[model samples]
Target chain A: MLIKIKWILFVTVFFMMGISEQADPLPSWNNTNTKRNIINYVENAVNEKSPYYIPEEDRIATFDNDGTLVPEKPLIQILFSIEKVKEMAESDKSLLEKQPFKAIVTGDNEYLKTANEDEVISLTLKTLTNISERQLREEVKDFVFKTTYPHLNKTIDKIVYKPQIELIKYLQKNKFKVYICSGGTVDFMRGMSKELYGIDSENVIGSSNKYSYNEATGEMILEPELNSYNDGREKAANIALIIGKAPVISVGNVGAGGDIYMLRYSQNGNKNYKTLQVLINHDDDKREFKYGEKNNISLNWADKYKWNVVSMKNDWKEIF
Target chain B: MLIKIKWILFVTVFFMMGISEQADPLPSWNNTNTKRNIINYVENAVNEKSPYYIPEEDRIATFDNDGTLVPEKPLIQILFSIEKVKEMAESDKSLLEKQPFKAIVTGDNEYLKTANEDEVISLTLKTLTNISERQLREEVKDFVFKTTYPHLNKTIDKIVYKPQIELIKYLQKNKFKVYICSGGTVDFMRGMSKELYGIDSENVIGSSNKYSYNEATGEMILEPELNSYNDGREKAANIALIIGKAPVISVGNVGAGGDIYMLRYSQNGNKNYKTLQVLINHDDDKREFKYGEKNNISLNWADKYKWNVVSMKNDWKEIF
Candidate 1:
């Protein structure tokens, strides 16, 4: 009888362990304090009977795309824009004579960098505005798929952090609403977000240009009108405008200008909403590149706001 | 005994009627089908035991500011931009000689209209980028406070729809995460979003520009770099990037490009999240100006996507 009872107990324990493993919040993440804390927060908030239970409506989460999700060592979008200028210059003989286009085609990063942001914006507008919205969509889609990140030697989509991707899914599983707010063009995000992050195009909000339907051509054309810049405080405003409510939980990496704004938005304690503002401090050097404390905006914000800083070096058991 | 029983019955009936009145959603709104449906849907979704009960995380909502929330009759932002340009042109004589600035100072709407979107964008960037971010923020804040809508003869904030404001507060009360996602600039939105909509700056997402901090000047500066246009697919991408999840319910007027994208983003159902897309179609000539049809991108999107179209003429009991 004792032997039989022991066998049953062992089987029951084994099954429970299997179930717990399956339910691990950060499966891709190595066992680390950062991952553990994140998981614990979600677990506490998601528990229906827990005092910290956040209603599903308030479970809004935000992330920065560029350096946080994918490798930003070579500046992906800028590189793409440069390559586009090169390609366009080859075909359009007039482009070679144009000042900015000529500079870009000649592989002049210094000149391009010195060129005022307005000039770069103007050039981008000129390059992109001539096409129909449909065409632009297709073009961006093709570019994302075809272009590979120079450092990673992989497509931009493929270069996304594996662990972060799992975190997004895990958040969703726990009834958290996740969003990607970037400074990239909304169209480009629409093309890539679904495949890469399982986020729909509409759920992605970013910087934008003016658009109008051409009556003569009967095509939806994107105009090169400078409308709005979704950065810093604007990033916060965009979140409020587009999301319609303040998020209880906001997550972002350093250098994201809008992180402070997000923290402020979440900190407004009204009703049952509890705000958790977390900043991912990239400090790892071996498995992943790290930079902050010098020119990093998020670090400055974290220090100023006293936000929950998750160091990659201290927080993670593994880096992906 | 009979007289006492009669008194008790009357009191009970009066108490029940009062409770019913309080329970009615948007009682000031006309008994329109759209209004009724919206109220019913929200009611059903809020009940914990209901199958349609949306968890707080998925109960994300979005709103458009211009026509939907505030009176956009004179196009407030455009007028402010024009006035700023005029002031700058007058103060700096050189601006008067510049093409777009000169045209703006002269009140040459015809010239302004004649210039392509690129030219307008270039002009806007040039005028705005020359100042520090702090200066720009203050300038915009003062402009919003001082400026009045011409026809209404009221402050822009006062011109916001009372009913819509109530709706925002109501959503907040119910724990729905709300955000304002506009086609307007992030800086512009930040200046007024909190005051007007009770949405904090961080929750607002809109169009943006590339900004950097100048250590030498000890100030944050905005560059007129055209980074991305946050419209259509871009709006959706921004939502995904910033919010990090699909919104279950999205609200907007016909002019909101982000709204259309939000609907699309939520509808793909890639992650098994349910979405409700509501379009505030302006058909009421008496209360609000009406525009858009098959030609309008947003309207076309609604029809193509089969979204819940709430006509102002038939949907609401009241305009404000």
Candidate 2:
């Protein structure tokens, strides 16, 4: 009996020590004042006895995926989608004769870039609709697993910033519900978010295509109809419609239409709602490409609004 | 001297009495329970002295315009946009012969309803592009000022619920910056949001069209290209990009996507943003058309997400 009790005590102590010694996934994060400030703020709000202690229900966090998590210097997703379109065109030679697909296959990036948003959308729809939903999901899964960022030479999924992932885990550990609020396609993101970010499909809100359930077939069918682009204030509306809760914390990189709406929804006065707006400024070029306020409308708006801009150059101690 | 002193005292007493006579905006709100709970939560998060108090830089707020602020029953904007299309088609006889324009000119509500989302969008683009941006803005403005809701018989803008408007004012009074985050067209909302909701053009975030600046002519031209539709998680991105801050509070109605993203963004561990996700559920058939989870995705998502559903059946003492 004495030996058993001693052994139990030793095991407990070892476990506790092991847990304490576990390194943060983002160890490169400098022990800077900014990091300390953020940690302190979280601690205060989470302490139940503290006046600032917020209940778990109010602890909601949102993060943008592009540029914020994954690199988007040369329009990463667009490139990938275009590549997928090319592959589809190659498989089905009929698509090779189409206007947009023809342009794409010929390596006419300039013409594709110059195409209006609607034209590009139409092309995307035509290309994406070539496959069934199940097939598309499988294809996306395969692509995500194998595809690597050309510049980083890392698997696209692995290109996510370690610090941001840590931030997400930390928030989740503190009972804050985290969501990936992105501009990417809803189905596409839904397919990968759980595996990539540990966020469930229901929690991952995004742009959607109109879908219908065929009563006779008893199968969900994707319609070639654009319902609404998840951008700008629509982003806010989608948030309200889907999340059904005002968030206390919001984070994003780009100042596109969606980010603005998220901030508006998060900050608008109502009962029991609080928010922290953060813009992840991409200023690191060594690890990631850097672009600021040249033609990026969202980035320009962030500066003009004097938001709490987190400089990748200064604030973050580590890149992806 | 005695007469003067008496007069002064009487005047002072009268003023004090007058001040006390003023009614509280929300007098029926239970002071020490639900109402106080809300106020305390907001105060704690907003007050800089408190540990939970978010700095002013982080205090972002977003509001949805359609059914949330104005009447959406029958979709007034869609109707107006359709009307504008018809009017334009009158001059452009060629458009009258086109597939979508031909359909619009028929004025068959059933046919229009049967039209797919793509068909509706294509028709709208054709009609809208018939006129210049300036002309389109003027036409929409004129329609808004002149038209009244068929059921309410009140000017469409006046159909705004007085209580919600008061809430907007209340938020502004408390130093919270507000924005109109809607799924409506950005230009259309920008034309009227300032006058109707006291939200500025810069603060209005919504679905948008790609525009071009004619440097040679010194004119900004609206292109027919649809850029991004502001919906779902995109709403969250818009908030972050435009507002450059996360909100401590978010107010939305059924169909507004702002709530989902707002709630998620509000729960950042670093920011400790609190959220009051209020859903303005329309259930009064007498004042406004009742709309909820009957057949709409918004209502369905709201129910599934367990949002703070504010039913018109229970919460509101009055409707516009």
Q: lDDT tens string, model 2, A1-320?
A: 99999999999999987875453433555655545655665776688877667887668777766666776654444555678778887789998788777877877867644443334346556666534444455666677778876678887777777777777887888888887777766666655776777775545766655544332332234567765566555565455444445566777775233475565456551245435666777778887767654467656655665445677777777776
lDDT of 2 at A139: 66
Candidate 2 CAPRI assessment class = incorrect
Displacement of residue A43 (Cα, Å) in model 1 is 23
Off by over 4 Å in 1: A1-320, B1-21, B109-123, B132-134, B215-219, B255-259, B269-273, B293-297
**Tens digits of per-residue lDDT for model 2 on B227-251?**
5566655665555443434556766
Runs with alpha carbons beyond 4 Å of true place in candidate 2: A1-28, A91-94, A109-123, A130-132, A255-258, A269-273, A295-306, B1-320
Error of 1 at B87 (Å): 2.2
Per-model CA lDDT versus the true structure: 0.66, 0.62
Error of 2 at B150 (Å): 28
